[model samples]
Target: MDIAVTLEGLGQGFIYVVIGILFIWLVKKIDDWRTRDFDDDVHIDDGNIAVGLRRSGLYLGVAIALSGALGGSSKGFFLDLSHLLIDGFIITLFMFSSRFINDFIMLGNINNDQECVKSFVQPDGRKVVGNTAVGMVEAGMYVATGFILNGSISGSGGTFVQSIVSAILFFILGQLALLIVGFLYELITPFNVKNEIKSNNLAAGIGLGGILIALGIILMSSISGPFTGWANDLTSFGIYAVYGILMLLIFRIVIDKLLLPTTDIATEVKEDRNVAALIVVVSAINAVAIIIAFSM
Candidate 1:
């Protein structure tokens, strides 16, 4: 075994374990407080916001640690890690920032009491997003990091300048896909109506779905021909990434919308059954889609 690789793996694994524990703990804390503060309603306090950041940090750390552990030297770790961390931070920032601004601006027409800011759900069944602006921001970190890392935007071989260019191209293409989906979701929002609460679950779902699908599509698009010549490989990888993101986002939605308020704080609820089933079906469809895409 390569001693350097072994040591690096050990270090990364240690960091991952630490980050995972912190992540679970922070999520639990956020869930507990969210249950108490915004259980039936959605107005989360600023303190809950701090808990959100903790969760985000946990995710960022975990992603970097895991990425590092996967047969890479420490030389590129900081650069790759920084890219992962900053990208995660930026995504989270934009997600929550968009929510806050949208909510605040629409406050007059739509009752400010509706609590739109805190309705974001992190992957691990946490209600941090629905309690405070911070929760969404925190959750956004995870989503952003997940997208950037899973999209094949890192560790490509090139000179410093070339690598920088590749990274930017990767990020820009992903964001461009996101923009297209965002616009599409916004346009389709009028078609899906659930309640008088001014919240559109279908639209939200579509937006989340768009992110995953677009990420897959754009990653494949970015890898075509001379760009990377790895279109086939990335598409195969993207099949999994898209499925994972969808499953994660679906859980996030369920926690934010369904299970949390309905469950009693006295008892613990594991995965929501309906949401789990939905994820299974969606994942299956994504898998099938991937097979078909590759076959053609």
Candidate 2:
């Protein structure tokens, strides 16, 4: 390998790093706008540390994931600046749009006031409380969205229009996966997920969030690679669906038997706000994600 070519690749990677930083800043602005009413005070307080950290993690994770995906398609480890900027813009658009979809699913229609925003407020006009559950759920959603977007564009050797269309298709597929996960959660749990999160049930929120991330990871493998046609895609989806279900079942059994033999996870999570149980579940989900990501 030529040293000059290697250096050029490194230089392009640095450019991506700079783009990631700028995108994170843009996300912060959007977050502020979304939660403006909650944090209306001019004086910034320290009450939202957890929320801030979660949001920061989300932005950075997405930026890195997307940049890495773009890097995979670059020529000889070097991306053209113009192409990098354009791809970055497209990714940023998809990221924000995905977040909007997540918000709508988790919190309902915010514009119609049929949401949970009011629950975060206090009579004194200060929303000082940081709901870690909601933050965790949102963070998981961001990771899921990033993975789906990344997988969609991972080896897409296509024109700009084709890439955009592929991204849109994968995004819709990702949303459908999320809906299925949500439905599964509802079937397994007795309590309502939105109500639990709105009431600050950290355990319930984390448990549901873990499932979302896990599904994203499982589907990521299926989404990557060349799109031969609709028939091939459908066949791939069927095979991956079986694999995902089996893997989830194994993880669930392992966590219950090995990780927490003395505890009933679902009951503990629903009734007691058991943070430890929730953490174990999230860890199990993420461990599977890591394994699958590496294998792919």
Candidate 3:
């Protein structure tokens, strides 16, 4: 048995675990700072689902970013840690940009941050504080950004300039793709996605969020691997993106029909507000995305 190799693996695992804990702590601090207008600690301790969802998304996105930076090369443990710290921090910032983009650009009609924290009253006069729908959208953005940022940090070859440029370019392109896909997703759905989400429909939120994260997973490979010049990479990335979008959209309809049969996905999401139906959509979409990402 290669005891030295095993020992090294164990040591690396231990270090990574420590780093993960630190990153989680950092995520919490960021959350507290972001929600400074409101007492996040109080809301969270009061069992606010909205706060929980937001925090979970941040944690999940950061974890994904860490994994991406973790990929490629073994330039010793210290070097790896440095790479992760630098790339991971940058990616974290990039992922958080989703909030601005979602609020002002993507879903301009919705104020996700405000909605998440505000309190409301249900029709039956029962008081509802947290808007889990906004939380779901935020969660999806975080996770999707994580996957896209993962692609940005991954790959090999190229000088430092080329790498930076590539990362920046891909990040821009990735956001654009997401914006377009999000628009198309809205078009394809029978119901008004934005309106539903605005009304705090958890089902619609999960439905839309599911597709965004799935697209992010599919696109990760388009920007991954060693740089082989801008033209080649751009063309490849563009082609792969188109394919991913078309296939994923098709899968959304086909899979929902095949699995649910009698149930209309549109009704389940828009009218019935069936979170379970959307969960099925998310699971199936992710399974297909993983397959397509690998096959590509």
In terms of lDDT, the best-performing candidate is 3
Lowest lDDT 10-residue stretch of candidate 3: 120-129
Which regions of candidate 3 fall more than 4 Å away from where they truly are? Answer: 123-125
- Order of all candidates by lDDT, from best down to worst? 3, 2, 1
Encode model 3's per-residue lDDT on 28-130: one tens digit a residue.
8886887789887788788877878877987898888678777887778887787777775676677667767866877777787788877877545667778
Report how far residue 36 has shifted in candidate 3, in Å: 0.7
Task: Count backbone clashes in candidate 3.
Answer: 0
Better of 1 and 3 by lDDT: 3
TM-score of each: 0.43, 0.81, 0.93
Q: At residue 278, what lDDT does model 3 achieve?
A: 82
Lowest-sum lDDT 10-residue window in model 1: 264-273
Q: Between 2 and 3, whose TM-score is larger? A: 3
Clash totals, every prediction: 4, 0, 0
lDDT of 2 by residue, 76-176 (tens): 43344565566666677766676676667654532211132323553346564555566667767777777777777674556656656777787787777
Local accuracy of candidate 1 as per-residue lDDT tens digits, 1-296: 89998999688667645644554454445445644644422222444443443355435533542342232334565664455444434333333343333234312244322343445455455554333322332233334434443433344444435434544455444444444433443343343211212332222332233234433433432332223434654464446445443443444344334534655211221222233433443354345435534543
Q: Who is ahead in lDDT, 1 or 2?
A: 2
> RMSD, each candidate, Å?
10.8, 4.1, 1.8
